[model samples]
Target: MTDISTETRSVVIEREFPFPSEKIWRALTQPHLIQEWLMKSDFKPAVDHRFSFNADWGSVDCKVLEVEPNKTLSYSWDAYGLESIVTWTLTPTGTGTHLRM
Candidate 1:
């Protein structure tokens, strides 16, 4: 007989940016802007949209799972042999915006 079990966990990273949610949203969605901070990608802020991030070391295959303009974005990140989902949430704040990843 064989037994198997599955476990799930989540790691959240939060940051407060003194910028509007709209501005942060652009940096996360727009490909050209993403290259500046993240990586070179053909990413689009649309559900089920397939994209890839290319780099000198390697490339990560990804697919957009969810998109909520200026609010939330979720995607699948598959690199090497590990698969994970990355979700970004933005909340309006008195100062600027609250970001959670």
Candidate 2:
């Protein structure tokens, strides 16, 4: 007999940037800016909008799940048989922004 576990885990990374949340939000939501940092994508910051990120290896299909202006963004990331949700949270800080992913 074989056993399978359905337990799920989360990995969180937090960073402080010396830029405002609005600026950080632009890098995350804007397709051109996103392409500069992440994969080439057709991402839009609107809920239910489907998009993809293309890379030399392959492509990742995703859909916007949530968006809250410069505060939060969540989406579904499906690739290589692994389906997951990626969320980004931006908090305004004294110096700049606190980003959580």
Candidate 3:
């Protein structure tokens, strides 16, 4: 048995990638690339386009909320009826793009 009360309150993940901002941006926004890295199931990028992610627990539905070019992306995590925000900040470095997630 698992203690649901002991579960973590919130999860925040931050990652940095050594790639150009444009490249990372595409991977985040583009549906095909997103399906490759993020989810194993089908995904579409239109606003209010409901999709499912077949996970070990169950399938979760999500809808796109907002998209800002190379900057910010937000969506609704329908499984929990919560709105989650994901932002990407791109800074040009001498060698490559400094991507902050």
Tens-place lDDT digits, model 3, residues 4-95: 45333445555666777778778877767877776655555456666666667776677766666666666666566544444456665666
Residues 21-89, candidate 2: write the lDDT tens digits: 999999999989999999999898999999999999999999999999999999999999888999999
Model 3 scores a TM of 0.60
TM-score to true structure, per model: 0.92, 0.96, 0.60
Q: Quick one: best TM-score, which candidate?
A: 2
| Clash number by candidate, in order | 0, 0, 0
Q: Could you arrange the candidates by TM-score from highest to lowest? A: 2, 1, 3
Residue pairs that clash (backbone atoms under 3 angstroms), model 3: none
TM-score of 1: 0.92
Give the higher-lDDT candidate: 1 or 3: 1
* Candidate 1 C-alpha RMSD relative to the actual structure: 2.1
Residue 99: error of model 3 in Å?
4.1
Which window of ten consecutive residues has the lowest lDDT sum in model 1? Answer: 1-10
Tell me, what's the RMSD of every candidate? 2.1, 0.9, 4.6
Candidate 2 vs 3: which has more lDDT: 2
With candidate 3 superimposed using the best TM-score fit, by how many Å does residue 91's alpha carbon deviate from the native?
4.5
Runs in model 3 with CA error above 4 Å?
Answer: 1-10, 80-92, 98-101
